[model samples]
Target chain A: MNDKITTPQTIVLIITTLIGVWITTLPATLAEKSGPDSWLMVIIGGGISVLGAAIVTSTGRQFPEKTFIEYSVETLGVFGHLFNLGLIIYLVILTGMVVRIFGEVIKVFLLDRTPIEVIILTMLALCVYLTRHGIEPIARTAEVLLPILMLPVIIIYLMIILFNGDLSNFMPFLRLDFKEIIAGTKATVVSFLGFEVLLLFIPLMQNPHQSTYSSFVAILMVSILYLFVVVTVIAVLGIVETSLLIWPGISVLRMTETAGTVFPRMDVVILSLWSIAGFTTISPMLFASAFGISRILKAREFKSFIVPLVPVAYMIAMFPKDVLEARKAVEAVSNMGLFYIFVVPLLILTAHWIRRRVLNR
Target chain B: MKGKVFILTVLIGASIFFHGCWNMMDLEKKTFIMMMGIDALPEGQQDKIKVTLTMPVPRQLVGAEGGGGPRPETPQQILQSTGNTVYGTIRQITNRLSRQLYFEHMTAIVIGEEAAKGGLDRFLDVFQRNKDFLRMAKLYICEGKAEDVLKMETEMEPLVVTYINQIVHFNSSRSLRAINYSIGKVITELHETNGNSLVMRIRPEKKEAVVAGSAVIKNWKLVGWLSDRETRGILWMLKEINRISVETSIELQTPQKGLVVLDLVNFTNKTKAKIQDGMPVFYINMRGEARIVEKEERIIKKEENLERYEKPIEQAITKEINNALQKVQDEYRVDVVNFGEHLRKYHPDYWETVKEKWDLMFPHVKVVLNVDVKIRRQGIFK
Candidate 1:
């Protein structure tokens, strides 16, 4: 846990974690809720999340060598410890929900006959092993896998735009009211939820002060990627078609065909890359939860908590029976994550400001 | 601790091979469906729909390409069954087959006139819900039984489905006579409350099949059809033209005895929809460049002759567009060219009120067609 990561590795972590299962489903969900103005919603929602990431990063910079768990206690005393325990529970539940979603997605696309429990257990076990290696290994793994995961996505999107995209779907722009745009932005906000992992990792960066700028850069990258995906799906599938499709991102990729290629199925390539993204997401969350478990128990080493936390995550992930229920569970976890990422940090920063200024005066 | 780590490594390594082949199905054990067709059943039949599946016999396909001593009797197999639902009939047909049925390679789905007219809502449900069906597969509406078209042998291509798929693909780029609609787009059309789309029409002849024209599907039912020329008009309005030749005869006052033909070179259009007098009005602006591919008797290479040639070609395009628009507005009364979508995108408030009664109001909507043609090239002798 003591090994430090550079600013670039932190950015890669933020990008990969945010790009998980949401890439396949966000376009359809946004299209259904926001019409053709879904890309606008993405920019607005991403702007709001950038403010949150900046706040969380600045707060981490204030306490140089300590993570969120240690600094919260230092600032708020007993209530801070209570908040730390709540964050730990939230992280565990978030890991569970993410694993459940990964399992369900694999079931739908690749291994349909296998039991979902086996899939969830296998993924959780791998994540557990990664978490046991501590934060440095996770960050390095993300660094190595980010390019491999993103190249295919970029190539597929470029091929689609160059060959098959119909830009007429973006017609009648700005027809949506402010209220509908706000509601659609709420869906985009959920996709950006995974960036909150920065809270736990800020202290582990080689230059913690640079995290504020690097985190914003990471969030901007995610926003651009999401905007590209959403706009591409809309342009390729049209608004009505995108809304009707359950997985418009994958559908658009599948619609693309390279001339005279032996391997024609772009969806298969997308799924493989998506698997890497999902793995990055699950491993980081698992590591975050393990860190939280160690902090709650006042233990020195988080490595001890990684193995025991796997069963807990596996049990909670298996709670959702079907895909619909799994989604509902994820929505609940996302709402909880929103509080930890925004309100808790904002309250801590406000308290830190008051303690330094008003009380000293 | 070292023993524990070694044991963990061994367990992890062993688990990969344990489940490596749990759900793997070899290529040989599955019959790859290349084409599918659905037809309506007879009056007294227990089932409401008849489903047909086409697949190539692996051994015969290999032998034919190898140019072996003798070709097999049948290179393809057609299986049929009847059930109340597509899924049920599919299950019934699969019951007799030894290998499992796979549909990932299916290139086309043909629907009979009866099934299409009866409504394609149910037939599309199976493809929508099933993960095996590729939404990119081409859809066709046959004049009679869809199974007949699937069973017809073609000399051009080894498989009838491959031949049909290639024709639809190539024809779509070269001319407006044949149009192909993917299952995904068709399913998307079904989602729209008043959206309309077209399906290619295929008619099986004696040892041959003709693919031309288009069948119009509006509100998930077949309202009518458009001939090859009328289909061209639809394509012109939709701006889907790639490289189509338009032949028009001009009566030159210069005493030319024979008719002249002009081939359209670069065709493009821009349509605008707006609210005027509490009704939707569309202004279609079309621009095309043409060449005098054939001339009967005139050898006038002067600029005046080219100017005179442009008006008759514009009139020819206008006449075709008007005829196509008239049939859609007066006879069938559907906005297959996406006029409603244009209004919905441009004028949302007006679209909300008219969207409910769009079916009734579509026939009365005013459309003004303005076509301008420029003679770009003349023959070398001219």
Candidate 2:
């Protein structure tokens, strides 16, 4: 179904995809590595991701009417099929870990008695339903849910900064060691891994040439939001305490008390709204993976492949035995995702350049 | 059409089975704990510790008349159980009661002197790790058994928990004698300072509970206590003072002296550290503004400068600060004024050299104080 998505819809898709389960634990990871300089590391990481997104978008623009799966075959022949298989595997594993982490967090904070298997299956069922509708519907759903996901987050950040923020927690500014900061930049870049969805969505845009602008705006928005999250969490909890927490974002919200108001506890409200964010993030990745499968098999409708992939994702989500193991699994999958997002795009561009210039085809 | 009907039937059936019924519990099936106290059991007892939980009785709270034969004297129920661990003790208490013990609404947690002295590191994890416990609850160290503080009666408030919570909020904002330290704040401070910090102190009297002063903790164990005046001094050094009255006798003429009380309205302080002779020297500068809130005698003339009253107030503050410094530095030898954190934040390189032996070198470090006070207003007569 060659339904076109507008520039604004593309921006919304990329923004929601970039923010997933990673937002809750990002501050703790950065605090453990860079201390008060976590905000600076986020900026460095965002700058690098912006450059990587630029490369991916420009490559997609080379063949305006073709998706990544289509153009890779035209440029590298047999090698492109292998690369396409790598992309599908990365997306499937990424979706699995996202669903698993979301289930774990909900079980801890909201529902203690519900089985985690029930949580995973329910979320996967919803994702499958959304993926069966194809790209235009997924983009529309993100456009509708972006405000619901962001307004509470922004309000919570403001309340924490106004009530409990301590400015001295960021003291001895910029005294971080050079090597430690470089190491932290690597972790921060992994949190920015979901932007690679642009490789599949660029060809579906109404004007594919504007993909660069769409990618820049989306990454800028997500980066500013992440910076706010890290700064507010560290400012309220301090570096040492933030590092000790599993979810510093939720902990910061827990510390805020809006007494004499209608809502005495805002953490529960913010978390319920955050479930919408989790749904938006997971559906887009599932859609991209199923679409890739349909293209490889020469099928006209991607809907046929959507149901079978659900059980595969369910099995992967259940692979990790515990929270610690789940984190290790996510790290392994993210490293593989980095290869597809960064190295593969550059290789495809080089092959296309050689074919056009040297072979004079 | 048949496939759509079958899919809809499956969706409806799944929703009926997975609608969060597994975790649902009715309000009547749970009991809300208002406050909790932990005390170390007496020597030679079977259990190591005792936990006391206070829950309000709903029938007594609403003053319902029909169902009860005779109303209870108190509106709350206090239950105590002894066990080896906190969670185990809670579960043991649950075995006797029909309703589950809920901690989401708990207002305060009081730790007894003996338990605090033993070490708090073991007891803090249950509150931090559990989802039911609230992080905003005020934490207190009692002078005696925590059970006595929870058992104390109040004339104004119906429950001791509400009484203690109100006093803490009021004193922390209007007076320097007490500081409100939430469990979340204490956890952060304990982690940052290696368990060297101050927690607000509470003591149970014959008829009431008093919330004042503070208890000093070193390496996760209670070391000593700071009195109200000394606590004010530590508050001044930490810049935690909001508004307090300073009373001192000022020289009016040669033979006559009068007591003048100044209301401190504004305060600001700056601390700087430097290394000299292999030791760290700290210089603190304090500036404050005050108004004439009360006076015992007419000691001010219309033409007399208000600046004359500034010197006595400054000396009074400096004396209070010095007394506190003497007790914390020489006697207890603990750094509760956050001097160690200040050094770590402003001087990271120098901190790296002495960070290992900071506990040994803390008491030897020298501190210099400078106070600047301004009397901005006088009484109505002036």
- Calculate each model's fnat, 2 decimals: 0.38, 0.72
Leading candidate by DockQ: 2
Count backbone overlaps in model 1.
Answer: 0
Candidate 1 off by > 4 Å: A256-263, B1-22, B63-72, B193-195, B242-255, B298-304
TM-score of chain B of 2: 0.88
Give per-model TM-scores.
0.93, 0.94
Among all windows of ten consecutive residues in candidate 1 chain B, which has the lowest summed lDDT? Answer: B246-255
C-alpha lDDT of residue A186 in model 1: 77
TM-score: which candidate is best? 2
Listed for every candidate in order, the interface RMSD values in angstroms are: 2.2, 1.2
Shift of residue B195 alpha carbon in model 2, Å: 1.1
Q: RMSD of candidate 1 to the true fold?
A: 3.8
- Model 2 chain A poorest 10 in a row by lDDT: A255-264
Q: How much is A277 displaced in model 1, in angstroms? A: 0.7
